[model samples]
Target chain A: MKTINKFKMQLCAKSTNESFARASVGAFIAQLDPTIEEISDIKTAVSEAVTNCIVHAYKEQNGDIYITVKIFENNKVKIIIRDKGCGIVDIKKAMEPLYTTGGSERAGLGFAVMESFTDKLRVISKVGKGTTVTLFKEIKSK
Target chain B: MECKLNMTDDTLTAELDGEIDHHTAKNVREQIDLEIDTQTPKTLILDFSDITFMDSSGIGLIMGRYKKIKSIGGKVKIKNPSPNTYRVLKLAGMDRLAKIEREE
Candidate 1:
């Protein structure tokens, strides 16, 4: 559990920033020398989390998203994406695959994609407060 | 994202480049839809040869297109997705609806 490196960034919860947030996390985690597949997994999971903030949490309002990446010993990387916006009332329903409150265009597979790509997934939220999604992965050396 | 369209008598082939995420998915969907609506082709082939990364947004894009094309009696074929992108598509069960082909 020794900390190796860490970085944090705060961004606008605009949909355009979704790519930026995921790419920034990918670049930061690149220092750990993750494989190509590992990089893709991390980026996809990060994308899903940030998209949830932009599409569901803020829901047409401006907000801020916080992203933190921590690299620890044993090549484990943990990422936390948080937003101060409308929170989910039913975590179980929200986590269900193809269960999205967004419009028809939304596939509702965000949480499923995040869970599949990472080793650990944790979500905490309050209806009037905010939501936080934390994802952890252990990079296997090539 | 850049989309290149190639059209023949009954097919519209679109070559997409760059990353496919929520940020770019809207524009991508619109552009492809415009072509499909105008051409009314029998088949729509999406070329993913240059897509470096894709997420659930990409899945939504594909699914949306599949529905639109199916409504007009057109089939959607996905071409040359990278292993990572293919994995995302498979996870979303896109393979069942659309044909995925890896170019040799």
Candidate 2:
């Protein structure tokens, strides 16, 4: 019992692309009648996830990020953000509070905030391979 | 972005316009820190009246400021955050740390 909708977009590993990815996902999912607050939360979570990739993965340089958005009929939205760049070596430690690898002003709260925004969050990574973050939200329609 | 910094006898006010996400948070935090360090105000007021959007990075920025001022025995206050931004701030537990005033 499932109806699925999927969207794929390729973006550069730049800060601006974070907003572009977030806005596109928000506008597309708004067709399902989510509230402004709900949409904003989704966008914020997505932006944080994507920005982590741009900053940590590509080190604020040029690279490609693949974002996939899926909509389920059970009032659920899932976002998968994948990057083919430097990956996290310690997933558990990275998810800890304030454990940042880079010294560039990152508080390491990106994953924490993303976890707080959605119902389910998962990260899969391998060193020198890539990283994929999947976020799930059970929509509370407004 | 246009950042307006105002200084009173004992208070420092910073009005940030535009979005404050990961891209801009570092710069904004640095600028505010420099001003606060130089002025050494007793109280810091952050006016987010014109900010359209923010993310978790903004929360980190605020937290860092809170820590900075707390060490100096000063207080930090936030004003006029948009409803959307307010929701994010609340989610991040900001209302518990600072006095959030809703005014135009």
Candidate 3:
């Protein structure tokens, strides 16, 4: 697929930045003219990935989160969120629904929601190194 | 984010405001739980009429609240979520645990 446009940003992996990540990407992707529903889905997926960086990836230390938004052909969009915090030791188990290690207040549903909202989802991680999450969604023409 | 709570006749209605994410969910959770712990209302109603956005953290917030009230034999009802928020809640299967009223 041919690439159309793209942008990248980095911010502190703080819980307060969750909304910032979602809103920034939402505003940028507004160029694609996504419907309200499609934009909402994109924002929700972005929120989950960014929140994971704050709660799990950077759990032990302060770090930075990098976000890349790219618009590809066929009205498809891809979002990548990366963090240099403690990586997941078990990618398969971690992706399972309701499998959270952050005590009870945390619902292990982060990955589940991201997977459900996006057309495609990918996660890559290495323990003692870092983690990256990618989300893909298609927008309908108005 | 803010949650305005009103209680009468053993029913506590919590009207939520603003966006709900990991950062804001914490404060909302504390406010609602404090009321539930002190008032011990028989029913807890989460009003999403004023909410503009939400994510999975909001799911955790509702689930934790549900567990808190259920242990005391109380019930939870979610009111007036926008269509998009309703979609997120349904993805988490929240509809199975509580009574959710979708906006018409």
**Top DockQ: which candidate number?**
3
For candidate 3, list the clashing residue pairs, or say none: none
Candidate 2: stretches off by over 4 Å: A1-4, B90-97
Better of 2 and 3 by lDDT: 3
Q: What is the lDDT of residue B103 in candidate 2?
A: 81
lDDT of 3 at B68: 98
In the predicted model 2, the residue pairs found to clash are none
lDDT of 2 by residue, B1-104 (tens): 45788999989999999888887787788888999899998888999999988887878888888889889999999999998888778866789999999985
lDDT of 2 at B46: 91
- Displacement of the residue B61 alpha carbon in candidate 1, Å: 0.6
- Can you tell me the DockQ of model 1? 0.83
| DockQ for the candidates, in order | 0.83, 0.48, 0.85
Alpha carbon lDDT of residue B39, candidate 2? Answer: 92
TM-score for every candidate vs. truth? 0.98, 0.88, 0.98
Which runs of model 3 end up more than 4 angstroms from their true locations? none
